[model samples]
Target: MALDARHWVAPAWGPPEQWRLVETIVPDPGPGEVTIRVRAAGMNPADRKHVAAPRPGVSLPVPIGYEVSGEIVAIGPDTRIGSGEAEVGVEAIAFRVQGGYATALTLAAEKAFRKPAPLSHAQAANLLLAGTTAAEMLERVHARSGDTLLLHGASGAVGVMVLQLAALRGVRVIGTTSEAGSERVRRFGGIPVAYGAGLAERVRALDLPVRAALDAVGTDEAVDVSLALVADRSRIVTIAAPGRAAEHGFLSIAGSQPASAALRDGIRGELVRLADEGLLTVPLSRTYPLTDAREATRFLAREHPGGKLALIP
Candidate 1:
């Protein structure tokens, strides 16, 4: 017998009204897998897109969430994660294929990792997706020490992580964000440039040319300014706006690909190590209970000006 919880259902794609809650069965762990009792989940911008788009044969009435933090309560065949080892009381962040928002989920051991020590469940909840995305993009683009990297949406969750990591590597990071988020950019080791109205000129006035660019903001302005400032098109990548990236000669980051698993795992391990060592931090805006999943997903779809939202299950 398995337990059940609120699983979100999206019958159609119009607005948030599509979400429906229904009881769903939790499954047992398989080989190399572990069952986690979800303690928290993180909402991402892509979750809203998936709910509205409802890709055919992909997922539906699907419990939507890619990132979650939880404890391992069950271990399965070929289980290296919880074998003869003590109970995994440490919270962990996970990236999943489906049903991440549920009360319990069974997933591969590598898809999850122990949470960074000292981070609350809510703080660690948002790190898996956003933090790993930043790490991968920076690596491929090679934003290095003494090289100027242009980043869009510097105040966002992923944007801030990129800035901090690049800064720690001694890279020259210039960022574009709203006026309200300028101070945050500075605090995260970026030179804040206003995102609109002469945005390109403002960056140029800083007396530095962009060596590479990464777009987290999914805006035309971000692509245009990156093309204007950076010389190498291959050095430009977009985590958002993949549909238009080809036209602008920017690299589309295909995170859904299988290779991303290795890269994401590499980054996750480093971030966890850094956090455990007390060298890194994650910022959160607000947290909602699992019963309020609709509210969390709705807010994640809208413009989040402060930080990432977490769901405590």
Candidate 2:
């Protein structure tokens, strides 16, 4: 069957202003792939960063978007989920898909998982990347039950996931956030501490031993506090600041980092189970129509919504 779809594309590496929405033919799924009718797509900072400076080897006119939640419309040959047949019309969430900012797209069957019934399409769309990142960082730091860790930017998307997942593992969390976000941090079972001047002193005042630290904010202050509190440099990881890793001797797990891939691929099914069981929750800040993507990017750039932002396709 032939399919046509509308999608946003970046004509070249530049600014978000350069992206244009246009019509194109949607390719059929190849072997081991399935076609999805996208309902919602999650937006991330990387979306704009990639547009501003395209990744190496990616040419112009690249489609934008990384994660989406939708329904299976067609399945390709040799596609099977866990030794079973693929089911059409089943809602699923897929991440790491190329060109997810479309009305429909084809994805490897293994890369998609059934969406939890409790989560809205917008929430499911935003789940995978942040969840996987959290899983990897926790693994990097060797986080375990009875451990206490400091998490910077704890109210943000990835941070929230880390906080909740840590809570599930019985690990205590001391989370840093703005005054406005403190309540949210607390809601996720983190000990909320306000960020900014005297932040290190405030964490010190807690008088609790910090076994490891994860920086999601990439701020100089966050880095300094983590360094001061966590004695082992190897236990300190930053998802936001890869360049600073060399100077500080801490681990960095940015996009495409080898240390992160295994956990990301291995943890998706578990994350789905956790979300389905009510142990993991993704908050939706707002949803914008796909056409308002530019506006959505602008809002994300300027505001700290403390939750996920999504685009309805």
Candidate 3:
């Protein structure tokens, strides 16, 4: 059976203003595929920035989202998800799939996993990208129990995950945030240090020996402070500061990079397990209607929003 769906697409490389919502038919799952009735779609910077301009090997009319949480409405023969055989009516989450900002979609079964009962659809939709990225950052720095990890942008989506994950590993986190965001860091078991002029001095005043640094904010101040506080450049990692990483000899990781992608893919199940156990949680600041995607992206780009954002269909 064919299902009708509405989805957002960027017909040309430009800004969110250029995106359009169009209706299409979602076909039944082919071999190794499953059809999802989307409950919520995860929003991330990459959902917008990746197609903002023409890039090599990318085609136009690109789908706008990469992750979602939904229910399996149909399953193809030979299809299997991480939880075992795919079945209709089971709640599930999928990541790294195209055209997620839709009422429904059909994607490869491997991209879908059973949703953890502890997380709502909105929270599940927003999980893997930030969770996997946070896990990889911790691994890159070899963060372990008894080590102090300096986390920049500590109150944002990835930063909050880092704080929580570091806590699980028994790693002490001194997270950088704005004055308004301090309590969020503290709530997640991080020592909040405000970022700005004299930022390095503020951290120095903490008097704890910094073991490694993780940068979520790609600012010069963040880079300079990490360099000043941490003696081992290899122990410092950045998701936002690739240029700075190249210039300063520090490490950088992105989902587009082969090594980073492999590491994230390998650990998706572990992160889900953590969420299932209630040790990890996604803090949703707000959710927007599916049609309000453009407005939501604009808000995400311009404001902090204090936590993860999602689009409900």
Candidate 4:
């Protein structure tokens, strides 16, 4: 059955000011692809960055969302699951190479994973990008039990996941967050220190020897404090600053750039396992229907980088 699809598109590059919701016809799944009826789609920082500039290799009038949770509604040849499974966190981030912001999307069969039943549509939607980033960064640094990890932006979705997961691995995680989020950080088994001015002093006051740092925040203070404390530049990874991170002598994980399928799945599986073990969590600040995407994006930016913003279809 053909279904109507609603999608967000930007005819030109700029702010979300260019966003327009249009109705389009559902396309058939091609060979090795299955169409997903997107129940929820999670937003990411890449959405804003990509929208700011039009580039070569990007399809025009394309839809834009990275993480998704949905059901298989149509299948191409040689597939197993046809429909009706509320597969959680079916990622289409690389689908960003194609697109994901639509009521329905055709994804390579190998790219879709069954969402665990323990997660809600929003929870599943929130898992893919942030969760995957956290897991990957931890592994990159070889963070381990009994190690003390200094985390930047520990209250945000990615930061929270990294904090908790590190703790679960027996690593002592010290983190930077606002006073408002202190309880949440503490609950995640991390010691929360305020992010600005004197952050290094506050962190060192925690009385733990730092082994490494993960800068998910991209703040100058994060770089300064982490570098001063950690000593080993190789163990410091920054998710935000691909250009300057290496210049500043730290490792970088450019989520805005291409990541390997193996790298993607490594974090995906670990995040799912963490959720199953009750070790992973996300702060979903709000959800908006697809029609209200502009408002969703604006609210997301102002919510001070905590939790997640999700679009429900």
Candidate 5:
């Protein structure tokens, strides 16, 4: 039997406004593949930003999502998932998958992992991108026990993950957030400082020497402040400010970088384990019906979402 699914795609290189929801046939899983009935799709800024313009090796009508949590509806022969053998009816989460903004997807089984039991579908869908990014940032700077680390954009998806992971490593985080987000930062064991004028001075007043800095926010202010406090350029890393990173001789990492990609991929299973043990979580701000992807993305662009967002298919 053939399966038809409705998924969002960028029919052309442009903004989210240009994305179209089209119905397409989902082929049966091939060797080493599985078909997932997507319950929720993780939303990330990269989903919209990456497809806004044509990049090398990309094609038109590109899929719009990178991660999803759902159930395995079908499995291919000899397929093995990240956890083990693929089987029908098992709940799973797939990252780096094609056309995740859909009711169904057939993707390589290796990309699928057993969803953590404690995580709701939304949280499972929202993990990995942020979690792995956070892990890499901390790894890049060698964040460790008793180190007082500076984190820009502390209330964001990646920043929140950094806070939690750092706490587990026994590192103390001084997280910069808006006054409105202070409680959230504190809830995750970060010392929340409002980001604005005199930010460096405020951090100095705290009297903790910032050994390493991680910038999830890409603003000039974030770059400038990170440079000011953290003495070792090698110990400062940014996900957003590559230009600043290059000019200042600091580290900048992205999924596009091969080494960073490999690091993130290696750490995925451990992150899932942390979630399974209730040591990590995704704080969700809202969820939208998959058909409302455009509206949801518009909201995400505002950059004020209190937490992660997801799409229910």
Candidate 6:
């Protein structure tokens, strides 16, 4: 049987205004994959950036989402769910999925995990990319118990996850944010410091021996401060400032980097475990209907909301 579904797609590279909602056929799972009826799709900056100006060689009419939470409707050969065989009607969350903006999409079975019982569809949908990114950054920096690290942009989704996960590991963090986000950073067990204008001096004034740093903000100030405070450039990793990494002699773990991919893959299951145990979470900034993806992207670009944005399909 064939399935039909509607999805938002970018037919060409341009602004958010260029995206279109179109009806399309939903394909079944192939080998090592499963088909999911998407309930919620999480949005990220990459969603907008990739659509507006897709990477070289990316095909046209590219699907516009990366993560989704849904119910499994069918399974393909060799697919397994957590060490056992997959079953239909299982609620799950998948990350790095293709065409996640659709009502239904097929995803690699290994990339799909059983949704934690306590998480709502929105939270589960929002977890994977940010959680895995946080995990990878920490791994790149070799963060551990008793260490004090500097985190730039601590109030954002990935930053919040890093703060909480670091706290769980007994690592202390000094997090940079705007005045409005300071309290949120503090609540997540980070020492909140305001960003911009002598930011390096501000972090230095704390008088703590900062062992490592992770830059989520990717500003000139963030890169400068991390370089000044952290003795070893290798221990400083930036998710945002990949292009500037070579100039500063630090490591950059942007999506395409081999180290970044390995780190993300290694920690995928651990992130689920952490969420399942209540050790981590994602704050929802807003939810929009699937039809409002354009509005959602514009809102994210303009508002720079503090938490994750999601679309309900």
Tell me the whole-model lDDT of each prediction, alpha carbons only: 0.78, 0.89, 0.94, 0.75, 0.94, 0.87
Which pairs of residues collide in candidate 4?
Answer: 88-115
TM-score for each model: 0.92, 0.97, 0.98, 0.90, 0.98, 0.96
Candidate with better lDDT, 1 vs 5: 5
lDDT of 4 at 48: 70
lDDT of 5 at 97: 83
Question: Where does the lowest 10-residue lDDT sum fall in candidate 4?
Answer: 88-97
Worst 10 residues of 1 by lDDT: 81-90
Candidate 3 residue pairs in backbone clash? none
Model 1 clashes, total count: 0
RMSD of each: 2.3, 1.3, 0.9, 3.2, 0.9, 1.4
**How close to the true structure is residue 142 of candidate 3, measured as C-alpha lDDT?**
97
- On a 0 to 1 TM-score scale, where does candidate 4 land against the true structure? 0.90
Put down candidate 6 lDDT per residue, 193-241, tens digits, no spaces: 9998888888889998899999998998899888888889989999998
lDDT of 2: 0.89
lDDT of 5 by residue, 103-208 (tens): 9999999889999999899889999899999999999999989999999999999999999999999999999999989999999999999899999999999999
Question: Considering TM-score, which of the candidate structures 2 and 4 is the better prediction for this target?
Answer: 2
Please, what are the lDDT tens digits per residue for candidate 1 over residues 1-313? 4556566656667566767667777777777777788888877877777766646577545567787777877767656652133244646667744767667787877677777777887777777788888888898787778999999989999999998789878998888888899999999889998988799999889998789999998888888888888888889988888877878767878567677767876677778777777767788888888778777767777666388887777
Q: Which ten residues in a row have the lowest lDDT in candidate 2?
A: 77-86
- What is residue 93's positional error in candidate 1, in angstroms? 2.1
